[model samples]
Target: MALVDVDLALIGYGGATSLLLDALDRHGVRGLRIATVDPVETARPHRTWAFWTGPRDAFDPILDAAWSHVDLYGPGGAQRLELAPMRYAMVRSGPVFARADEAADRLGVQAVRASAAALDDDGTSVTVRDAGGAAIVRAAWALDSRPTAPHRPGRTFWLQHFRGWWVRADRDVFDPSSAILMDFRTPQPAHGVSFGYVLPTGPRTGLIEYTEFSPARLDDAGYETALRSYLKLLDLPELAVEEVEDGAIPMTDAPFARRPSPRVVRLGTAGGATRPSTGYTFSAMRRQAEGIAAALAAGGDPVPPAAYPRRHLWMDAVALRAWDRGLVAAPAFFERLFTRNPPGRVLRFLDGLTSPAEEVALMGSTPLLPMARAAAGDLLARIVR
Candidate 1:
């Protein structure tokens, strides 16, 4: 076994870990030795990350694309909407990977390509295997961003699985400046919701995705069939698919531990940073990275932030509980909220922003009977405990 020492050790180099490195460099924390291990040859490559932003986002320097217009389509039809003061932006996985790697090289941080085997409870140490045998490393703090196993005893768990096709056609069939928010004309699962999302990258190129927020995943043929149906429904002709991107995002009531131990901190999805309501984590990742970098620089043991705001968690719990009980329609719940609230406000709410007053008003847009019953029952159980 080989052993090395550093100030920090990172497990993965996804959005969260990469952003932290960038922040640390910007703070002029020079010559800080950090080691990272990820067997994955490159960072995110096959996924697209989209987030809602107020003006002048912190990570705008590396933002790959942005759009100002938003549209929502329901069973009724397409509703065109505009956000004057807010923007919806997307960052591709490859560019994020490149930016992180470039910063690491310039900052002289040690980047190791290895798979982690285990970590000691002492928390500051880890064991990983490279091409050779076992290698042991020690740091003042270690952050693991790998997805944690879900373990919510009685609650149901579902994954939001999606397949996006980057397409270019001979003719323009997509709006270059607007995001197709959701087309709920598709079939819904008996237990959950499903829809299509489109983000126009350019006049001739864009990403069209078929997504499902259900407990189960579709077979290969099932996803293909769904995509075919969606394309047909939108009256898109035989467009060549430039690329296919697919992945899964977990949604569970599982209590993901923020700090696994005093010495080990978790980040990203592994730290339960995924928002329960919408499964959005890009912006949350930025927040987590900022906190982590500051703590590391100050020589304090770092701990992950609570995954979501308390209010947002409560709202998600209410919605998920209602979904589990078959009391509310997912499409209708979203439709009413979007119809009543401005697109920016609704997006912010989904992205875990809003005042208490705004939250209450947004909740009121829904048929309250189902969510109220769920919240009441949840509170009663808490009281009993």
Candidate 2:
């Protein structure tokens, strides 16, 4: 049997790998052969990726929309925040995946339509196989961006589950200039919290989602019922559903190894790109892709940097514990954070780009006693185990 040789073999053609391809193109690193493996021909599904950043971002070319202001509604009432010098941007996955696929084709990267049944790496090369046959890809390195296996039980785990509908109305009912970041008027869960998110693309059309942060996920029927109830609450006459998008994102502090072997590295959610506190991963994955590309171009090891700063991880641990224990009300905690700190600072903190002073100020906005107790309990549990 003949073996296939390339500079890199990507295990999945998802967001993380796509971003890596984009970075490689940007760096003008061409002529390196590559192979991508994925079972699906199209991207996972129609979905929207939203993140906060300034006007200049690496993904500006594929941005679907951007909002300069965001609204937060809670028990304290509606607070409209102006995120000047920063924008809340939304990018649809279709465009991003298509662009990446085009770039791969242009660069002469081979797309292998098969599931990777097995992977064997020996510090110099990685050989992957499928039931149909086997192919030994000799390369300096390989990247596996496949979705990670389920988290082990008894590890602090939560899910940011959501179902959204792209809706259109007969009359103008949405303001396209701003987004409704969180509307806590929805029914709250006994264990966690629920909110409604609105991203208006036009005066009469937008994507409205019912999102929940909880230990368990809801069935499709459950999400549909919630969405219907929310639409009734809005009382928008002549509303029509254009499309639907739903997904479950893991929110856990469970450790995910980035470098599973000396020559093979993990990417995307498999590499801890998803933040434990907030289910935000696009920006983190982009940063990881950039780092990986730069390292490979420099003839250095392409090990991804830590998914997040140590301090940020500690904060996430305490917050997750406190929320799971119901020590503090999730809606009120978030409302207070947005109410006390400036929106830009909060966005930066969520993006893991906050300074020491900003972090301290942000911490001061939370329920101190509950967080302290949660931190202490977590520490004691770690010591005992």
Candidate 3:
């Protein structure tokens, strides 16, 4: 029948929209009608996100914990890395959603609880339709965060999958000062690479996970086996498992369609926020939300910017080819990276923030010959195809 008309409508109210609303609130933008289309409101989050950034950001208030340094464990030994200008932060999704809801209410943003099945974009406005072909809402612009299965046809794909446990022990077992970014001491996977990640909230409390980068995800029992094996490496007392978090992030070289139509744009992972190599997405989406907020406030186009430059994407594609083809030994590869290069440089490079010369230096630290060959092969394969 009638529609909930607004200036802008968000198809999903997860991290991307929340961050956008948070930034808009911070910038004191007002007088525009906004609405969010989501099927259900989340009361609790079974997931956690970990990201590294320089300085503070909008989500700092709800940050569960932060670490100024991190431990990188490899075949040789463990090295304590000082993240000077940057700090690693963790945020649970439940609190993040709550914060966004509060902001939406204050800004008078409406919520339509319906699944957006289709978006029809005219030159001036977009109409969101549900599965039954009913108009759910209409807006001048639509930012769709809905994610499809990441298995894109005809693209190189990989999975960054993990199962983590929030555990506590009576004994002070963890060095809480620095989080463990990667522990390669855990048994390596037969196909891809495997590592242990630890984020200690305290001496006896932390989230420990067994992570793998491979073509497919492991089953529940497979994850349990790997996690238990990793836990044994840490000398501790009987553990109390407080929570469990499990998920798979798609790592792909497929170019995402940012604009489905003139008035409809994509956000979050579907918009190319996840890095193909590391599966880190929060930081990229966070940066983009801020940009979108600024543009809307300044009476400018609010399209989300490219998450990373084409050159950076090309480099990541080459790395993926190498890893997928078994051209480089990942454990020793990453081991030498952290040991030989400045930790900040490596972290920046992962974010695609490093300069060309710096990138060359970093590439020099890897198996240069193998990577160069991989890059050449990747180029030729694309050309012939």
- Which segments of model 3 are wrong by more than 4 Å? 42-44, 149-155
Index of the highest-lDDT prediction: 2
Give the higher-TM-score candidate: 1 or 3: 3
Q: Which runs in model 1 stand beyond 4 Å of their true positions?
A: 42-44, 58-62, 123-135, 151-154, 297-300, 380-385
Writing each residue's lDDT as its tens digit, candidate 1 over 1-385 gives 4576777788877777887777767655566678877767643565788988777776687776677777778755778778767888898877676667777887777766676666664643544444555666677777888777754442547788888788888877777778887889877878789999888877777888999998888888888999989988888889889899888887766667777677677888878778876778888887787777676668655564665678787788778777767888888888888888878778878777788888888999988888889888767756885
Question: What is the lDDT of every predicted structure here?
Answer: 0.77, 0.85, 0.85
TM-score, model 1 to reference: 0.92
Q: What TM-score would each prediction reach against the true structure? A: 0.92, 0.95, 0.96
For model 2 the TM-score comes to: 0.95
Q: Per-residue CA lDDT of candidate 3, range 309-351, in tens? A: 8888888888888888889877878888777899889888877
Report the Cα lDDT for residue 231, model 3: 85
Model 3 has a clash total of: 0
lDDT of 2 at 350: 89
RMSD of 1: 2.5
